[model samples]
Each structure stands twice: as structure tokens, then as C-alpha cells.
Target: MKKRNKFKHFLYLILALAMLVYALPLISFKEGWSWASAFGVAWSLFAFLVIGAHLHYLLGVDEEKQKTLERIRAAKLREWQLKWPEDTQRRQENM
Candidate 1:
């Protein structure tokens, strides 16, 4: 798991660098910013924020493991509690 997480992080770093290289060139630093230059910079920043957020979320999460844990919890709850129909029946009887 540690190795996999490291690999995933490395991949995200590479992607971020690639995106930066691709989009940074679109911006012009010359005096009197044109509309196109402003738009390019905004678009690049937006892309970075979105991709960074996704990578941040992905780094800490393991979907398969989370699902398995959830299933185990559900199974334990079923073992400890009355089934739905039985509980409903008991409730009706009490009323």
C-alpha cells in the first residue's frame, strides 16, 4: 500500500508539472495585458486548482479498501441486530 501510494503521488506530480509546462506558455507577461492573455492565465490557474484538488483527494483514499471495510461493518451490524422484517414484525406486535 505504501509503495502504491508513493507511485500514485509521483504520477500526480508528473501530471501537474506537465500541465504547468503546457499552460504557462499561454500567458504573456508583456505590458498591457490583452483579454486573451488574461483568459489564458485564468484558465491555467483553474485547471491547476481542479487537478490539484483531485490529486489531493486521490492520494489519501483507497476505494477498494474502503468498500471492503464498509461491507465488513454492514455484516457485523446484521449479525448484531434483528433483520428488517423481524424488527418490523416485532414493532407491529407491540402496537
Candidate 2:
């Protein structure tokens, strides 16, 4: 229902698909696929997993940053409210 939850679900789906794509080549290679082709596929899968791990780490960092920002923003807003109760009342009056 919430946008943030939707985004989390979408991110999970993307990661799953990426992992599946990276694994497909290995399964095919085990089924008597060409040596050269299998090597290339395996290498690509290795690279994909490495890159995916890096991206996943970066996403975690970004999520932390977002939470920190939200907390800072909320604190600032609360401070503002406490400092200017009259202003808040004035704004409500104008509305």
C-alpha cells in the first residue's frame, strides 16, 4: 500500500531476477555445453555476482543515508515547531 514498501518489493524482484540470470549459464554449461562458451558464461556470472554484491552494499548504504536524512529532517521540523508555535498558529489561521 505504501510507496516505500512497493519499492522494496520491486528491488527484491530485481535482485532475484539478476541472480537467476547469473545462474542460468551455469546450469546450461553443465549440460555438455561448449567449453569456450561455458568458460565465458562462468566468468560473466562471477562478474555479475561480484557487481551485484557491490550494488547491494551500496543500496544498504543509501538506505541508511535516507533514514538518517529523514531523522534529521524530523528533528529539525520538531525544533522549528517548538521554536515558533505562534507561527504555526498563524499559518493555520491563514488556511
Candidate 3:
């Protein structure tokens, strides 16, 4: 899963770069404006938006997993408290 995420990140980076390159013609123009230049710029803008949204989604998923782990840990700690109240109190005092 880590490898897959890394691969996906790199893939998005490469695609964004490629779109940036394609859109470069829109800025550095020796000739007059053309439909292709406009299209390239539009395409690159869309790619930027898509990549931003995808990264945001990935961040949200990670945060959700962290929240889930915290809840699980809290539940286990409560169970341990119920099962061994004195020992748990002693350990907390030691910590």
C-alpha cells in the first residue's frame, strides 16, 4: 500500500509536469494566439485542479485512519481498566 501510494504520487507529479510543459506555449508565444494554445492552458489548469483534489482526498483518508486507530486504542484501554483496575492505575502512576 505504501509503494502503491508512492507510485501514485509520482504519477501525479509527472502528469502535472507534463501538463505544465504542454501549457508553456500559452505563455511564450512568437506568433499570434491560437485555439491550440488556449486548449493547452485549459487542460493544464484542469490537471492542476484534479491533482489538488486527489491529494486532498488522500490526506482525508489518512486522517480517518488515524482517528479510527485512536478510537480502537481508547476502547482497548477502557477494557483493560475494567479487567485490571489496580494494575492499570499502578502503570499510569509509573508513567
For this target, which candidate reaches the highest lDDT against the unseen true structure?
Answer: 1
lDDT value, residue 41 of candidate 3: 62
For residues 1-95, write the lDDT of model 2, one tens digit per residue. Answer: 55676576557657756776766655554546788767767766675666666566545766788899999999999999897988888899999
Q: Candidate 3's residue-wise lDDT over 4-40, tens digit each?
A: 9867876886777676777675564456667766676
Per-model TM against the reference:
0.49, 0.34, 0.43
The candidate with the higher lDDT, 1 or 2, is 1
lDDT comparing candidate 3 with the true structure: 0.75
Q: All predictions: root-mean-square deviation over Cα?
A: 5.7, 8.5, 9.4
Compare the candidates by TM-score and give the number of the best one. 1
Runs in model 1 deviating more than 4 A are 1-16, 61-80, 83-95
Worst 10 residues of 2 by lDDT: 22-31
Q: Candidate 1 on 4-58: residue-level lDDT in tens?
A: 8767766776787788888787678786688988888888877788677657666
